[model samples]
Target: MTAPLILHYAPDNASLCVRLALEEMRLPYRAVLVDRAKGAQRLPAYLALNPNGLIPVLETPQGPLFETGAILLWLADTQGALMPAPHDPARAHALQWLIWLSNTLHPAQRMLFYPDQYTSGDTGALRATTRQRLITQFDLLENARYANWLDAVTPTAQACYLAPLLRWPALYGGPTDWFDLARWPRLSHFARRFEARPAARRAALAEGLGRTPFSAPTPCNPSEGSAI
Candidate 1:
């Protein structure tokens, strides 16, 4: 007997990537919303699944899993699709970026938007510093000459991960000029292409992110979190 798949998600959370991946793979699963605004993630039941109190805890037949990157890799490997072969060099490359995105880029985003979550003092200066760091990180990615497997006919886990994080920096009420979309033409183009995909659209709609997903390079109207 096959174990069931259940995804605990908050609308517009990093779970967006997992939802998009499932749709891309045509996998069936249930999504349970963990309302952060109402503190559902902190409840004892949810805490049993993920002590981190973060959005997006994926419950698999084996057990509950936290961390978006790990969940994505597991799905891709187990589903035998949406990622390079396990031993392929491309798979290694993909893992490298996934770690960087999850560890560095994701936290930078959290710091920029929710500095208060990390520090008690005034956060204005810290946000500015973090924004610059993010710009530098983006610069590295822009010039890395990395191949976008996501730009393929089928979207990969890496592509799914990139789409949301790229969108948030532009729309998180941070200074627009600090991280302008125009600066990273390659990434901007990548995001636009991802947004145009049917699977991406479905995920966006399912997450209540509205139709015409990623309409413009402006602040996202929906409440979103990157604590994957």
Candidate 2:
């Protein structure tokens, strides 16, 4: 039997994305907590796994894999599930949106969550601007021709990636009053449907994300390690 993959993760962090994907895929894995509250990620031992000290490093038979997007894509490709095969016509479109989640939406979220990192001054202004940008981005996603790719019935890496992105604004984005999932009807529907899945439920329980983790998130009450 193949050895279980090792996931180095912190509760309710980007690691949650990988955890959701793993559960959806029914892949065997072991979860090892990295206590972010203690700055364990910055220590040399964890740095050996991910030099950038990011959350969610998957220790594969090939080696340790970092970056949530790359890890998801690798899992999809290796397992031959959760994404379109390379020769399929839909593969290009799938790759496009996946990269958008990684390069575009995720960075905007980072700015909202940690405005001080993006600018030395006027973090409030930066957050306000990023909030608007996120709204515009969500609007574009709502109307995208490929919006069907985020199907609630069939889990995709994109869906796994997007669910957390959708959840974070409500919990971590400062001054979240301007944000409302209801504004984007399709995404709102997606959130409700996706969070109802068995895989999502298991992930929520493991990570201490309460019911309605995607549709209406609350701060995690993880049994171990802080989100920060």
Candidate 3:
């Protein structure tokens, strides 16, 4: 069978999650670089493929799946292992957190890190305020969601989807004083595991991401965060 083609121009973190799922499952697939950093995803060909112009377009035999969460759910259902079986209570519970990461955690990062992309400059102050509101939601998610990050009983979709958020405040180059990793020890511990996985390392290298700094312990300069 021909491997499905996955066209992704994800800005490092988004690509990371899909790469993790694909590698963990050992599925044969193709990775087409949309290279959003170079404005490739914004081109007409890519826009036609995904109107939102987001990375992570997973082209399966069934059809194309856009959005990372959508693609993840498709993978889990078709392959049914990244997550537990749907009929199982743990599966439904895990599924909720997966959706939460996509809907809640992911959106917060976009607002906090790339407000300019989704909103105008005139709305900068307002966008920043809105991002704070979103951050509260993310903080709530950190506290109440992904409670099983350290359980490791059967790999219920835990922190795999949250690597981006763990790196978010740093990704945008900000004070970690307000966003505490110490508060979520389990996830902080779990995140380190896959972020250093051989497959993850290979994928990051393939995407041209800087090797030494991939798992950033330091924040970027506050003023230097740019839209990708």
Best-performing candidate as measured by TM-score: 2
lDDT of 1 by residue, 129-195 (tens): 8988989998888777556663466688888887888777766745766766668887777778888
Which lDDT value does model 3 have at 134?
Answer: 56
Ranking by lDDT: 2, 1, 3
Against the reference, the lDDT scores of all candidates come to 0.78, 0.91, 0.62
Q: Where does candidate 1 stray beyond 4 Å?
A: 215-228
TM-score of 3: 0.78
Query: Which of 1 and 2 is ahead in TM-score?
Result: 2
Candidate topping lDDT: 2
Write the residue-wise lDDT of candidate 3 on 1-228 in tens digits: 255656464545475567667766777777776655578778998888789877767777776778888777777787877777768777767777788788877876676666666666655575557557755765575567445644463333344566555766654633345565555655556556655766655655554444422345443221211225
Q: How close to the true structure is residue 10 of candidate 2, measured as C-alpha lDDT? A: 94
Candidate 2 matches the true fold with a TM-score of 0.97
Assess every candidate by TM-score.
0.90, 0.97, 0.78
The residue pairs that clash in candidate 1, if any, are: none
Off by over 4 Å in 2: none
- Which 10 successive residues of model 3 have the least lDDT summed? 218-227
